[model samples]
Target: MSAADDRLAARVRALAAAVEAAEGRSDAAVSADARAVVERAGERVAFSGSYTVVALAGATGSGKSSLFNAVTGTELARVAVRRPTTAKPMAVSWGSELPHALLDWLDVTGRHLVPSGPHELSDLVLLDLPDHDSTEVSHRLTVDRLVELVDALIWVVDPQKYADAALHEGYLKRLAPYADVMMVVLNQADRLTPEELDRCLGDLRRLLDAEGLRATPIMAVSALRGTGIKELREALARTVANKQAMTRRLSADVTVAATALAADLGTANVPRVDERLQRQVVAGLGAAAGVPIAVDGVRRAWRKRGTVATGWPFVTWLARLRPDPLKRLRLDLTPGDHSPTEVNRTSLPKASAVQRARADQGLRELTDAATSGLPRGWASAVRNAAGDRRAVLLDRLDVAIAGTDLEVRRGTWWWGLFGVLQWLLIAAVVVGAVWLLANPLLLGLGLPQLPPVLWYGVPAGTWLLVGGVLAGLLLGVLGRALVEIGANAHARDARRSLEDAVRAVVTEEVFEPVEAELARYRLARQQVAEAART
Candidate 1:
């Protein structure tokens, strides 16, 4: 392939990539049209650019077949007066090798090779296409298809129908973007006088200007009388020699395809997920996961466990009789050992309808916010991405919560100290009770009497008993207050830990997928923009 062909092929490939990226996310009609353009252009570019392919397109009875025969110097295409003569396309190749591959791609079976002649215009393949306005549907369809594939368009118009709306509005106006590869010819010019010819040519130029085809070349020719065939031949020779018609035509196709898809790529910036949306998602998931109830369980469990460790020895057993709050909820309140043990499921209730609705609403709001400036189809795609895995969302969140280590089992330094103090008090009470009982037993046995010792006007044995009882009760009260304070702080920390776990799940399951889609859109838009430039 030539450098020019490679460049054209690159542009076509880029367009094809963009269209594929947008296939399910854009308007079906627009994407289909773009895909067709890429396919047709690929087929056309595969053939060598040794010759130029020009088509003579016009309405029925516009003398196009006559001009085709005149150009080829033979009666190749059938010229008739029965309304529509050419039903299918006829091709005439001069001097250059036959482009069988190209003709096969064009589906043109009616082909002829011109006899050896002046090699000035040898590298030209002229096609006589079906009438654009034929009453037969197939003829018009064939014309429409060939017009897009040909390298250059030579519209053959007669003086009588030069101003026809079908010629100007249907073909010329729509083909304004391809003016570089387009030409207009007034055929059968022998019938008009010099003044009439000039006036007609001037009026045609004005009409072409109105159709945005001001740069298109115009010529006066008579295929039958051969008045201006030489000029037309010279023009064809110049175009074939340049060999840029194929490149120009392909470039124009890319531009048109890109324009059709412009609506889908309205803005360059991809939408982003805001902090508010992230917070809302976390809140909803937390609610669905019963985070509040779990935190409360942590608090209650800490208090009960702490009481067993530091409560007065007399009633510490009572505390063990009641069920552990965290255990009942099926949670391990113990600090994580970082082992590979299986995580326990929480007995929290399933999310109610109201909770589910709130979560769904938050997801919708996130989608809307992220896709605010995107096209409708792209916005819809993003919204669909957000909800694509919604059925599995709650299950995933529950797993995340269960895997979290709430650090509820972490013990405070004061807890151990209080435990030791409680044990010492129990020992003191035991020792003092033994002393009081032994004193009475010794007196009853009539042993030798001993002097009585007193503290603050009480006997020594009585002092020991009363002090132990009062001090142990006071220490128990202080330990209970400390346990309450520690439990409250622990609950707050557990709630934070659960929230962090829930946030991570939301990011993985929801935000990442949506961002990935936006990244795809960004890449597609970039490809389309580059293709358009080419």
Candidate 2:
């Protein structure tokens, strides 16, 4: 617990932050007991740094209380009476001052202080814990709490119960993370012959090793006959002298919690967003938004303008009477109105339920592909983010359509030119009809008639009238063909611009939120890894 503990402090903080980060997201992020472990570590470290709280835990017949008394060289644990566990834990402090705050935080109501003296175990605060195998629920609970909170454990077992399954499976195996500060004591070794003691110790060592505690220290001591009491005291003295047992125990608890969190965190490889997927989404939403209908309107609107400008001079006014197709859908943004008004919601037909369903399904497929290998919790989170703005999706779509400038403005210059030429041909036909009528009048009045100009031996008046009418009809046909081509190109431009607007809306409503959630997951994963590193 010196300069290097600074690193331990930082690691513990990271683990605490991770637990806090995952608090509301998922319950499986960490075990329920991990919070208590974190709280204990924080309070213990802030208190007396010199004191090492070592607990002696065992079953009812293990004689662990007597072993505790032997190590302390005092009758503090009441070896004759086993009913002492009916009370709280008994802590005998070996230092001059009482660690009232520390013991109170430990919930140890029973406290004792030995006179300050030059002893090797002065920095130790030894606890005689309740038997773990007690039938009473309170005693078992007491043992369970102290087992997790104590800085070190000296598990006292006898030759008869050294291979007990409850002790090995329920406690030892589960506590493999704390092996650095845990030890096994074979109490009452004097009752067994030397050969029997060797056999029992070897067997117990094998059991501990199989439980993933290969480095856990083992000592055989007969508490009643004082056989190995001196060696146990020397072991505790060395454990206390370093003043790092508490730090190690807290670090172990951090490991246990971090392991649980890391297990709950699934794979960290979030797939990159594919533009094709985005384009597919845009295409799907475009259908739902009636983009095809809008483009058709654009084509018709362009042709309508052309017809009013280039149709037969006699019929052009009738073409202008009909309403433009795009204006009917409220998608008609006039030229030079660069910033379309989103408030002018489109009159386009609302999407049917089937169309809405397809849009939703497409979005789901896209998200699933993006987070394919992620765990259920994170995937659910991302899905939640994607759907967060769903209630207003249609409303926002209306805004996007209304704000699109469809570029269906003035027709090509050929329409105006054709209209002027058709007007000139009509004038020629009128003049030729007047001249033909006047020729008869001149003859009846005995006046000279004008000479008739001829083309291909036909009367000039007849040719003027017939040729002008035919030429006007041919020019109208040619103008219609040109307008058809220009309308298609205009429709394409309109479709491209509308699709761009729809993509923006989809990105705002879906992609941005999902990516933010993915970013959040990455940060949490990095913190978890930092906490998990030993």
Candidate 2 wrong stretches, greater than 4 Å: 1-4, 13-44, 81-86, 115-119, 267-269, 333-343, 352-354, 409-478
List per-prediction Cα lDDT, in the order shown. 0.85, 0.81
Q: For model 2, how does the per-residue alpha-carbon lDDT over 156-275 read when each residue is reduced to its tens digit?
A: 999899888889988999999999899999999999999999999899888888889998999999988999999998999999898888888888888888778777776568666688
Please give the lDDT score for candidate 2.
0.81
TM per candidate: 0.91, 0.84
Best by TM-score: 1
| Stretches of candidate 1 exceeding 4 Å from the true structure | 1-10, 81-84, 115-118, 268-270, 333-344, 441-464
In candidate 2, where is summed lDDT lowest over 10 consecutive residues? 79-88
